[model samples]
Target: MSRSRKVTLRAHPHGPTPGWAEVDTPPPAPDSTAAAFFDVDNTMMQGASIYWFARGLAARNYFTTGDLIRFAWQQLRFRVLATERSGDMSQAREVALAFIEGWRVEDVQRLAEEIFDELMAPRIWAGTRRIAQRHLDAGERVWLVSAAPVEIGRVIAARLGLTGAMGTVAEVVDGSYTGRLVGDLMHGPAKAEAIIQLAAVEGLDLSRCTAYSDSANDLPMLSTVGRGVAINPDAVLLREARQRGWEVRDFRSGRRAVKIAVPSTAAAGLVAGAVTAGLALHRRRQRVS
Candidate 1:
């Protein structure tokens, strides 16, 4: 289940995005028995990888501007609220799965690889990455546990040279997606369950493992490990981490209070700008056609 791939970061070909860096660490020795689990959104990267993937699809005209707007709104809520509600999860599951209903497994995988290099790679938080690298340096297996499609998670893990990844599995038949999930989304308690199952298969001891996340939704996953680190935690997770004496690492520069308050408005503005541009581009294309 865990396999290591060598990753070497080169100069950014698509210009700069925030938090990009080149790691100079030597190769890991793989001496440790314990492993580390990392949450994807906000913890490993600055934003939702799935949203970025959707944006890429939208650019390729795979979906309409309206579809992108809806996804952008959901992603904004995800970033601002930082809490995973059942309704939100259900809606996200539907939206995420519906878009790729008939996509070939290989085609989606190829797009995911392109999306990672173009959008996801630049958004990676340098601080969180350094921590992941430290675990790699110590020779412990590292896996990205995400609610995103497993294909996206695997791309990220492979790009970062992690041991592997676990994510929501979208069912496929005859090499094409069926637009349905195999089980529940790999989120909240489901994340913990996946880790527990993986541990058993990989001969890992939960008592010696560590998990990192940004949301209180992952409290189940965090508690499942011996050491839990909250990376840029939301207000709820921050409070919980303090009470539980879990390690907290905040890489954001602003005052803690500002971090919580600003995301809603800031992210909303970003989505609005994107929608405006998308609409304008759509209109132009329509006029030309």
Candidate 2:
């Protein structure tokens, strides 16, 4: 009794690109009984998950402001290059872990909770959230899948009360980050592979599953599912979505829920309420210098 809806956003291209060209995609199935997969970065949020994570780290002093600025610039440059090669994926991981050295697994998890409301909530596409809720209301599983780290995924899933989430996992030992991923990056072809493996583990049928994405890079995941809906897809994906007759939509003009930013004081309170030793840890680090 559930159906998929394509929620598109107006693409904002920085640098020399000016803007993204219009795209035409296919229609989706009239009705479907399947789980829906959501891409976390541009698809679910306003921008990249890694970018937000870097900002959060910088705010907490885990990363310096300059480090975060460089990280953001690197991301911008990478998008401009438009390369989907796996080597780029490897390099991204190294960059992410380099700044997170010496961070306790628990502290990051605690900060993720604060940012979940401050940063993550506002970035979720309204149309996408509605579609996901519709499926959940109909008793279908709604999973948030992403290449972002597991802590980031968990924060989002918990906030939304989602059934589950699948994301990149970093190696951890003795309650600290090893700064290394235990497996292949969860992107491009790897995303599709994760879905297939998840289906086997969760006893779900791939032929009955649905996936929603905004980028051509997610083709492997979109193609693997029985139902694929492209939401404001990229040029390359728009052509493929049209060929496959997948549903596409542009939700930029629609009315959306207003998101209020949690004030710095409120965020500090939340962090304090979540952990008694939060401020102590910050002070302790200062005294060591």
Every model: Cα RMSD to truth: 12.3, 15.6
How many clashes in candidate 1? Answer: 0
The residue-by-residue lDDT of candidate 1 on 1-289, one tens digit each, is 5555655656677777443455555554565559999999888987677657756766777557564565566556654554435645665565446546666899989999998899889978889999999898887899999987899999999999998999989899999988788888897899999999999998889999999999888999999999999998888999999999999998776674354334323553344335434544554666799
Which candidate has the highest lDDT of all?
1
- In model 1, which runs have C-alpha deviations exceeding 4 angstroms? 1-32, 69-95, 255-289
Candidate 2 lands at a TM-score of: 0.71
lDDT of the candidates, in the order given: 0.78, 0.67
Candidate 1 global TM-score = 0.74
- For each candidate in turn, the TM-score is 0.74, 0.71
lDDT, residue 127, model 1? 95
Model 2 CA deviation exceeding 4 Å by range: 1-33, 69-90, 253-288
Q: Evaluate residue 188 in candidate 2 and report its C-alpha lDDT on the 0 to 100 scale.
A: 84
